[model samples]
Target: MNSTQQWQNVTWFEVDEHQDGQRIDNFLFSRLKGVPKSRIYRLIREGQVRVNKKRIKAETKLAIGDQIRVAPIRYEIKEETDAPVSDKVAQSLLSRIVYEDEGLMVVNKPSGIAVHGGSCVAYGLIEGLRAASGKKYLELIHRIDRDTSGLVMISKKRSTLKLLQDLLREHKIKKTYVAVVKGQVSLDKQLINAPLLRYELANGERRVCVSKDGKESKTQWNVQERFMHGTLVHASPLSGRTHQIRVHGLSIGHPLIGDDKYGHETTYKGPKPRRLCLHAMRLEIPGYAPIEAPMPEDMQSLVAQLRAQKADKVVVSDKDDE
Candidate 1:
């Protein structure tokens, strides 16, 4: 116990066809009795959930015989805490890993899984990573929304974390995203330059809104494809602001198809999508060139289907979000 790295045993799990398309948290709860849904969520955010050595979406459809890697969190706590039932927690948590390394780890978070905890849950992705890695501490370099999925950047060392954070602040890091917008976009590309006002509630929950008196924000958007029914858009923000893409899309009158926070039109009508259609498609870090991750098949298929519908305007651009 002199070193920070400790190892604990975790049981592997199998997913039956009956639970084929269930969200990751739900599956974990059903299989891992006694584990709180919130704790399972924290584990998924921590990069502890893995499937066949790769990070995956919490709600990622499980194929038959999918193997998962799970480890219990062992903390040198200031106070005694209840230990969870062992095998049950392990079974649900081990199925969604895409990749991991000492330098960084990438996780495919589900649409409903928040990257961190807040008013609803006490622990978040950062807390979970510390437990899962059994390290003194692990840090997140960046985060996707609770409902956004795709690659997330994590750092094992504070120095590495600082380097990445600096790069992001200076606009050296580039994040690429794939999304479905509600309307057709005429422009091939456009930019949104808006300001954002961020508010942290009393309970530490945060929300962003557009205010003329807010901080500057910018978003560049391109039309990847336009469908008959809607447009598929690719978005990249010059600045990282909470719900930047979602709010900007709304400001331009074409909200992201499934984002309830920003899609006022769609939300009023009904749930157009089962999950938010935002994906952290790619990221460019400080390196020889850049690292790019492709969009998940589900989103790709969604765009392809929309194209078949012959969308008139398919993408949009908004400057900022709170």
Candidate 2:
């Protein structure tokens, strides 16, 4: 129980002996009597519900003697598909676009914006995209980590969604990324082969982490530039796995510079780039000519600062060599 919770409403439910091992969200969904499932999932996403007095995942299990506190939620019944999202928000979402055509659109998503709204997001990227284009069938073809900035694919038609999904399955499209990490990496290039599994903590959210139990993932990277404070690298993934780049970067001891959730810390020794220093720099489709997008100005400035620092170190080393 939070020391500062002045709950506007509270519902207490006792765990039955039969439901003792069921996931908290599942248990609540079955026993809450009248609340909508959408609202229940949203409550889990928004940190409103508590199990044993600790905020937890929808998948968390209810144990015996656990005190479940359902917080004060204004449960408004609305279609999950028709939640209110406006066109202007979709137009604003245009700033993230990397490439677009009739069949597919690729967006350079920001670090924190979700591609699709789930129970907690309320309004998702597609909701805005739907309002912006006024297209009824717009859909996301693939997934990206919520905290990673990069190329996201969207389909204009349901048939197109299947086509594009097939392309991804066949590895028909190629995506490239650039990431700044905390190291002086010396290797020109290497391949990282690892597997990932969704890891859930006792009371926190779930995240993808490397494990023997995970699915196969592969990544190739080359050190574009190295600095005393870190290394900037170009990344190419052969397989699209959740958090593959971020996890591989961290595994190699060079977590993305500002990825606090995965990278551990944000501040650097030199100039600071405010967001996660990762960018979807290029995309190549099997049939079309390659499309390249340069790093956003914010990330470019940080790279310049790192190179300048590297030059200063080089000058000092050269003078010593002389």
Backbone clashes for every candidate come to 29, 0
TM-scores of the models, in the order given: 0.64, 0.69
Model 2's alpha-carbon lDDT is: 0.70
lDDT of 2 at 221: 80
What is candidate 2's CA lDDT for residue 192? 79
Off by over 4 Å in 2: 1-88, 265-268, 311-322
Minimal lDDT window, size 10, model 1:
76-85
Best by TM-score: 2
lDDT of 2 by residue, 1-322 (tens): 1122132468877765544445565466434424545567668877778877778986575666788888775543444345555555666688667678887787777677766654345555766677777776566777676666677777765456556666777888888899888766556677878888865555445568889999888888877787878888998888877678888888777788877668666345867768888877777777777877777777888888888874423221212110
Q: Local distance difference test, per candidate?
A: 0.64, 0.70
Q: Write model 1 residue lDDT over 26-110, tens digit each, in one string.
A: 4564344344445565677677888777887554545556777766754322211332224433332233445566666655555
